[model samples]
Target: MRVPRRRRDAVEVNLTPLIDVVFLLLIFFMVSTTFETRQALELELPESVSGVAQVSSPVTVVVTAEGDYRLGQRALSADELASRLSDAAPQAREAGLVIEADGRAPHAAVVRVLDRAGALNIRRVRIATAEATHTEAERP
Candidate 1:
């Protein structure tokens, strides 16, 4: 009597389900993510009892406590500041300018930024300020 033998096929893995799960995880992470903008300069803005919320984007000029000037994230000298402002005249004029001066920043430093803006004829200028968190009794 002769016995018959059966051949076995090659073993294989189905990766479709694995790939689908990976894609699902990727989409979940993307949907759960949030985006925000951070300031380049760390500043303690002066308190204001009448501070208004800003609605539009504007060209920002930062004046540090040490009287240093920053146009965007780049440190600029007085001469450089003037040049840059002039170079972006049209945009600056259209978008307007916002000065974010530190609470302890020198008055002259802020004035210098203002002078430049005036020279460039930028009409809409606003100083960034934090809302006051004090009562009448708290005021000196």
Candidate 2:
């Protein structure tokens, strides 16, 4: 008598579960990630109803609550600020000037920076402000 042979079927893998798990992991990471802004100086900016977004990178001058001046991370005196503004006049004139004055910062300090920028012939000047909160805006 002759012996009979049986044929086997090819194996197949289902990848739907693996693809679902990968998509879940991607969504989890995207939801858990946080985006934060870092600044060289800590400032509590005043709230404003009509603040506009700046389009260009301009020369930034930070005035702290104690009325200290900081050009980038370096603290500068009144005279030093004038000299530095003079040195950066060309760039300032082109990109404009941005003054970030803390909410508690002295008015005199901000004025001095404005005066220096004016003398340097930097006409385009903007003051940095935060958006008004809902509660604050609702108050009379």
Candidate 3:
């Protein structure tokens, strides 16, 4: 008696089409995307356990524990800070403002700086602080 011939079953998990689609997508994104640059002006940014990625084009106002105010690295008085914020409002790229103060700085001082910044229609503000000085702290 002749035995019946068996047919091979079809393979189900086809990755070839998926791989081609993925590769094409990668190539398209690589060709069309522009990379953002890392700025060069350096300062020791305070570390945080829950800090988010720093935003681009922030107007940084720093206050020392002794009550000195700085715009980036340049110091500014209360009136000067207000004037600068008012002047720069028209040209600022971001509506967000970042004010970093030393640990010992008083809340009132921080409030004062923030109030003036608010007058210029700066809506978003954040306070920056270092991670609680834990030993063996690692960079995230």
Candidate 4:
């Protein structure tokens, strides 16, 4: 007697479910992700050839063209700035103070900050400036 031969069928994987899952994940990430816009004062920094690297988390004083003062992101009056600097003397002495003054900022404002730093005896004070691209002679 002859034995009956068995027939085999080709196996296939269904990818519709996988494609649907991938699409769902992509949509979920797209919907859950957040986009934030940063609002800041547009400042043009003075150029210098001797600018050094900033300290780690130094006390930053921002002087605007309008002569407004910002101490580490908070706006402060001269009196408040003086008081705050006095209060932060110990830390500022160790880490230093960074003065980020706009190119068009008042000379008096910058001088005032420097004088305050001088009063505090904070020897590590630094003036922040952008790197100068042109030579001194090239500048008018």
Scanning candidate 4 in windows of ten residues, the lowest lDDT window is: 34-43
lDDT of each: 0.85, 0.85, 0.71, 0.85
Q: Which candidate is the best by TM-score?
A: 1
Q: lDDT tens digits, residues 1-140, model 3?
A: 99998998987998999999999999999999877442333334455667665664457788777776777656788878888777666544274677777767777878898888777777777777666455444535
Flag regions of model 3 displaced more than 4 Å: 1-49, 91-95, 133-140
Model 2 score (lDDT): 0.85
Model 4 RMSD vs true structure: 7.4
User: Model 4 residue 35 lDDT?
Assistant: 61
| Consecutive 10-residue window with the lowest summed lDDT within model 2 | 33-42
For each of the candidates, give the backbone clash count.
Answer: 0, 0, 0, 0
lDDT of 1 by residue, 1-140 (tens): 89888888888999999999999999999999765443556899999888889965447888899998887667888889999878866787888888989999999999999998999898888899989999668988
Please write out the lDDT profile of model 2 over residues 1-140, one tens digit for every residue: 99887877888898999999999999999999875333457899998878887774457888999998887657888889998888878988999888889999999999999998888789988899989885564788
Q: What's the lDDT for candidate 3?
A: 0.71
lDDT of 3 at 73: 54
TM-score for candidate 2, please give it. Answer: 0.68
Candidate 4: clashing residue pairs, number: 0
Better of 1 and 3 by TM-score: 1
CA error at residue 3 for candidate 3, angstroms: 99
